[model samples]
Target: MTVALMWEARAVAGRGEELLAWVRAQDLAVRPLRRETFRAPQDRVLVITWWDAPYDADLPELPDPDGELVTRTVHRWRFEPVAEG
Candidate 1:
């Protein structure tokens, strides 16, 4: 099975680009099979990484950006695909 790690954060006021740049510069300890990034309204940034492991597996995650760049603490979630067989 494969797992997905979702990390999200919201920038403080006009610092969205700064926060996004920080996210793009991160180096993960464990490389993922694939990764994608998204931007939303309200200065929100979302990153999704796909890994070849279970949801409970230990994987390297993106650390929180500097305090001045974000409004609140970072949020993260793990997910697994439902089996059809």
Candidate 2:
């Protein structure tokens, strides 16, 4: 099966670039099949990693950034694909 892990965070005011750079620097202990990063208004950063594993399988995920860099704790979710084109 294929699973996707989503990690999202909102940086402190005017720190969007730093936050995006930090996310890009992170290295997962075990590499995923694919990974992508995104950013949006409000200094939000999102990272999605695709893996070939069971839904409940243990997997590596991005760790939380330093407290001074973000407004709140990070948010994460795991998903299994439901459909495709």
Candidate 3:
């Protein structure tokens, strides 16, 4: 099965660039099948990593950034593909 882990965070005012850079620099203990990052107008950063594993399997995920860098705790989710084009 394939699992997708999503990690999202909102940076403090005017620190979007630093937050994006920090996300890009993070390293996982094991590389995923694929990974991607995105940013939005609200200074929110999103990272999605695809892995080959069971839905309940333990996996590596991005850790929380320094408290001073963000506005609130990070949000995360896990998903499995149910359809495709």
Candidate 4:
């Protein structure tokens, strides 16, 4: 089974870009990771990351998301892709 990991954060003033840039450089830590922009407001940012994995054990879970996730809260989603697209 494959899973998609979605991460979000609300960045402070001048931190969004810097934080995102840092994440992009962490290619060696996580594999098959893709980042996308959900929205961007002044002094706040909403971003989503998709990570392909074989199973839960193959994923990197962020226990303390607050460090990177600058929002009030964060969430995770697990799903199986539809067939016959």
TM-score of each: 0.93, 0.96, 0.96, 0.51
Candidate 4 residues 33-68, lDDT tens each?
A: 655545456534434445555555566544433365
Candidate 2, clashing residue pairs? Answer: none
lDDT of 4 at 4: 59
- lDDT for model 4 comes to 0.53
Report the lDDT tens digits of candidate 2 across residue range 1-85.
9999999999999999999999999999999999999999999999999999999999999999999999999999999989767
Q: Kindly give the number of clashing pairs for every candidate.
A: 0, 0, 0, 0
lDDT of every predicted structure (CA atoms): 0.92, 0.99, 0.98, 0.53
TM-score of candidate 2 relative to the true fold: 0.96
RMSD in angstroms between candidate 1 and the native structure over all alpha carbons: 1.4
Off by over 4 Å in 2: none
Query: For candidate 1, what is the lDDT?
Result: 0.92
Alpha carbon lDDT of residue 63, candidate 1?
A: 93
Pitting candidate 1 against candidate 2, the one with the higher lDDT is 2
How far in Å is the alpha carbon of 54 misplaced in model 3?
A: 0.2
Answer with 3 or 4, whichever has the higher TM-score: 3
Candidate that scores best on lDDT: 2
> Which of candidates 3 and 4 reaches a greater lDDT?
3
Using lDDT as the measure, name the better of candidate 1 and candidate 4: 1
- After TM-score superposition, what is the CA distance of residue 20 in candidate 3 from its true location, in Å? 0.2
How well does candidate 4 score on lDDT at residue 24? 49
As a TM-score, model 1 comes out at 0.93
